[model samples]
Target: MFAKLPLIDYQPLKIIDIAQVYCTLTHPHFSNQIITDIDQEINIIANKSQITCQQSIPKHEEELKIIAVVKQLLTNLPKYSYPKLSLKFKRIISLPGKSDQAIAYFQTDLLTDSISTDLIGGKLNLTYNLNSCPLYFSLQSALIRQQDHRLLPALAFEGEFAYGNKDPREILQIINNWSEDWLTFKEIINQGFLG
Candidate 1:
């Protein structure tokens, strides 16, 4: 019977865009042949959200792969072959219905980076850096209506995080555990406090 209560039946918001995974590998151990092999075969994996690289590794070649999480997809990129590399991951969350006043829902303090224009609605972009670690978090607002017959405002917010200078295995583990992190992030954002 309690299921009917408005508060009890509250449903959390959902992300609209597929997560994009990214990675950047830099190490002195990479051999010229290994780099060339990875560069030559990197194009075969076309799906940005679910990337997997399969290449022939030379003798003594390190089996290193960085699996980055974007949205809900897992990207397995071959990194043992590169001496320097970087990738970007992005995900978007949106709310439907009358979002005419959606900009007001966001807090001002969290608007560390913001842009406003007459063509589109207000936007907020936030960035957080772990001073001691090689990791950073970024959030941005992308609220614009698309060209459609029906009124569907693209009241969306994007969240992204990047990390570097870590072991490939450790990076993979973090990517595998990102689901829980995503859940916690969603909950925190839903509360209208990105701080």
Candidate 2:
């Protein structure tokens, strides 16, 4: 009879590690393929968290919650100049050969002073162009389609956080606070989808 062995615990794979490996072993359509693979992995991990509520149409209440989060960020930085408010809806071709007509999918745009906070395709993007970085901050939920055509959500973050002479501690604090708020917003969105 063989002795039983203990199970081995493993740490989660980092996105950077996965990217490095993929980049090393390049293949055809590597960019798209890597993204798809990563998305699939994220979806798998997300499903484990019990994302049950999937709806065919995204609700208005959800949008309101997201907007509230952005507004809260602006409110925190009262010293900064008030940015102009603009609401822009982007329409995309829902189906093939429908170039003439397109359905408005995501709500995008919230120009707060120099900061451009956008909600596109269920992702929050904070862009600060005054500094060297173009794409400053981003948070995205790993969106997967349910059998009923609904979507389940998972969270992911991207973008650079670098120290520069142009960005003072106060400005950096605002960005940091915004990121924290974004995380809170993600939880709300997750619950909305799950609940």
Candidate 3:
């Protein structure tokens, strides 16, 4: 139902390959983390919409809650395996139809990896080889496990990996750096502790 809506500023993502029992080419943790975040937002939206009609209060509170939840989810995510990211994203394919401008492909692409880091979130900092716009991090998330069960601090979110930077030059650097370890890439970009 929320397929066409753009709740976040970025393009809407389809949380495919949730790894019920296994995974394919995609980075298991990163892909699942992305899915977790998206589903979290969906849950918030659904809950608010379900009860908003019953209550007279505006949905600003629910929106804030959703944001807070996302932040916490980010905080709880575990770090990525650095070099493993580039290898995992061996390929990618997107197919967005009219009105439904969304990506519907899996595992494949042909981009030279570069690297970059950002001080966007204080000192935590994220580093990546920009191949698929990586955004690595570390966390202990209480996310849903396989078999529809649950687990505490299950190393949710792949910790790093986004779709591409807004700039092509910087994006190039990010992708090119994917061959290096997280520590090397971190030092190259001068973010913080790379290990």
By TM-score, the best candidate is: 1
Residues 69-96 of candidate 2 have per-residue lDDT tens digits of 3344346634443222211111111112
lDDT per residue for candidate 1 within 1-195, as digits (tens), equals: 001112222134434533334443333332332221234523224332233333322222233232212212223335332221223333444445455434433332323334333323455455545332233344444454456644433335445545545555566566566545445445545554422
Query: What's the CA RMSD for each of the models?
Result: 11.2, 21.8, 20.1
For candidate 2, give the lDDT of residue 93. 11
TM-scores vs. true structure, each candidate: 0.46, 0.21, 0.20
Note the Cα lDDT for every prediction shown.
0.38, 0.28, 0.26
Cα-based lDDT at residue 161, candidate 1: 49
Worst 10-residue lDDT window, candidate 2: 17-26
- Ranking the candidates on lDDT from highest down gives 1, 2, 3
TM-score of model 3 vs. true structure? 0.20
Global CA lDDT computed for model 1: 0.38
List, residue by residue over 1-195, the lDDT tens digit for candidate 3: 012222243233222211110111222432222222343333311121110101111234343233234234324432311222121211111122322222111001111123112211111233455544454543211222335453211112223344322333343354344334333333432232111
Superior candidate under lDDT, 1 versus 2? 1
Task: Report the alpha-carbon TM-score of model 2 versus the true structure.
Answer: 0.21
